[model samples]
Every structure is written in C-alpha cells, then in structure tokens.
Target: MTTHVYFDGGTKNGTTRIDPPFDGDLYFQAGLFDKEERYLRTDEIQVVDGVTYTVFRFTA
Candidate 1:
C-alpha cells in the first residue's frame, strides 16, 4: 500500500499556518515535486494582517 499526503498551500485546516520548505520538502520526500506545483507570479507570496501565505492551485 502507498500513502500520499499533499499540502494544498496556505494555512493548514484554515487555522494554523503552513510554510514552504517544510511543506515543499514533504512533497519532494514523497517523490512528487520539490516546490510549489502551481502558483501566481503576480501574487507570489503575501502576508495578510500578520499571517504569511502563498496562493497555489492544484490542477486535476
């Protein structure tokens, strides 16, 4: 059996913040992509209020 986990980007579960490197590393370790799969160049990474996040898209 194989288990796959993905960090959809942005916060985790709409509360705690999830950052790159950590999340990205997970994907890489899992044999996926090493970095964010898809995101907007214009948006890049943004810090709203006090939370930092990146807007990414999961394509099917």
Candidate 2:
C-alpha cells in the first residue's frame, strides 16, 4: 500500500495550496507564519476529479 502526499503544489494570486499528508496538523504550520496571529485564513478543501485529495490554501 502506498500513501499520497503533496507538498506546496498549486497556487494563484497570493494563496498557496498544500495537500498535506494524512490531513496533518495545519494549525501548527499556520502558527509558524502567524506569529502575531494577525490573520489566519485557509481555503475550503478541494478535490480533483477522479481522485481523493484534500486540498486547501494558506497565505504566507
């Protein structure tokens, strides 16, 4: 069995999409960029046709 993992893939405008492994901890990663916790935003999970992928976006 093989697991799927996606790094920083896909982007547009100022948002970067990342399909993290096993839907890993995103809050932690966002914390890294949001030291001051000013504005933390993420897009809705998107799935590609015929594939199971949890996609979301975060601004850096």
Q: Which pairs clash (backbone N, Cα, C closer than 3 Å) in model 1?
A: none
- Cα lDDT of all candidates, in order? 0.34, 0.33
Q: How accurate is candidate 1 locally (lDDT)?
A: 0.34
lDDT per residue as tens, model 2, 1-60: 112322233233233334434434342233344442122223434345544433333335
TM-scores of the models, in the given order?
A: 0.27, 0.28
- Return model 1's CA RMSD, one decimal: 10.5
Judge candidate 2 at residue 36 and give its lDDT: 27
Q: State residue 18's C-alpha deviation in candidate 1, in Å.
A: 3.1
User: Which candidate gets the maximum lDDT versus the true structure?
Assistant: 1
Q: Which residue segments of model 1 deviate by more than 4 Å?
A: 1-43
